[model samples]
Target: MTDAIKANIEKILQDSHVGPMATVQNDKPHSRYMTFFQENLKLYTATSKETHKTEEVEKNPFTHILLGYEGDGFGDEYVEYEGKVTISNSDELKKQLWIEDMKHYFDGPEDPNFIVLEIEPIQIRLMNKKGKAPKVLEL
Candidate 1:
């Protein structure tokens, strides 16, 4: 059962690159859409060092992510990712997740202001697939 859920989650992560990432600020939930890159069960998204989300994560590591709906309608499967976020300036990772579109935000992956938020999921729930109850994966 766990294997099936893990595989389902993996496929969701791979197919769902864009999602809303929510963080806490002043005890209020702050959320914004972001393009995500995944490695195994981990997720990464790029942002500027000065972004509000960056500061929010430093103060509060907890985050919630929703990804993997194809927008075809009610049956589209998705995953809810609840995790801890870490800010990273490592060029190795920056290069790995970099894309030409990012040029508008920074000079390059080496830009000092370029940073990535690393999210490690504490719980993942497979959602909205065939009307079944949400299957959870707790790490």
Candidate 2:
């Protein structure tokens, strides 16, 4: 990828706070909005172990994520992520990614039901009207 594209990708990853996470359930696509956090290219999201989404992920590890689009206008930039997810129960990771707002769903970072969904992207496509072709990022 060119430096400009790389920079734009990083900016989107850093600036966007929410995204749609899609998972398959009963042969149908299920999607929902989620708050996202990233460590470099790796994506992380918090969830309760009791949720249906968590159960769906346990059955199928693959996921699709849509991020960066703010609905400002046509031609807005966005990223589509194809990845495999693994559930993390690590206390340290939970603590590291925890925020005050998370208390609403989780008792605290130590809440047993609290878990982190780690997404390792196999392919990421950076797309917008400016580019003639979508920038396929290296994993």
Candidate 3:
């Protein structure tokens, strides 16, 4: 990866704690804000298995993630990721990604309704600042 892209990627991962995840439901787009963590260069978000998002992903694995943050005198930088979602039941993954603060949402990593949204980015488009064309990278 180019240094600029790599730097932007790290800035995104460090600056933002949540992103909007978009999924398709009933042939329409649905989006929701979610807190995410990163592992192995992939983004992870956990949701209830019974939620609409879980059902949507089961039918269509494609998802889009938008993460952004305002920078110090650098305007805003945003990253868009196109990825395939995988329904994960891996206990180890949950354990690894678990945060104490997140327990309020999940009861625990072992909660029956809990499921992981593993987004493996296939393509990334990053806009470093206002009025600049995005830099696109294939993952």
* Model 3 clashing residue pairs (backbone): none
Better of 1 and 2 by TM-score: 1
- Please identify model 3 stretches exceeding 4 Å from their true place: 71-74
**What value does the lDDT take at residue 103 in candidate 3?**
74
Give the alpha-carbon lDDT of every model. 0.93, 0.89, 0.82
For 54-117, candidate 2 gives per-residue lDDT tens digits of 9999999999998899887768999888889999999999999999999899989999999999
- Weakest 10 consecutive residues of candidate 1 by summed lDDT: 68-77
Error of 2 at 115 (Å): 0.2
- Per-residue lDDT tens digits of candidate 3, residues 1-139? 5777867776786677688899998999999999887754488898889899999999999998888755454657888878889989899988887778867778888988888889888887887667678888645
Q: Which ten residues in a row have the lowest lDDT in candidate 3?
A: 68-77
For model 1, residues 1-139, the per-residue Cα lDDT tens digits are 9999999999989988999999999999999999999998999999999899988998999999999988888778999999999899898999999999999999999999999999988999999887889999968
Candidate maximizing TM-score: 1
TM-score of model number 3: 0.88
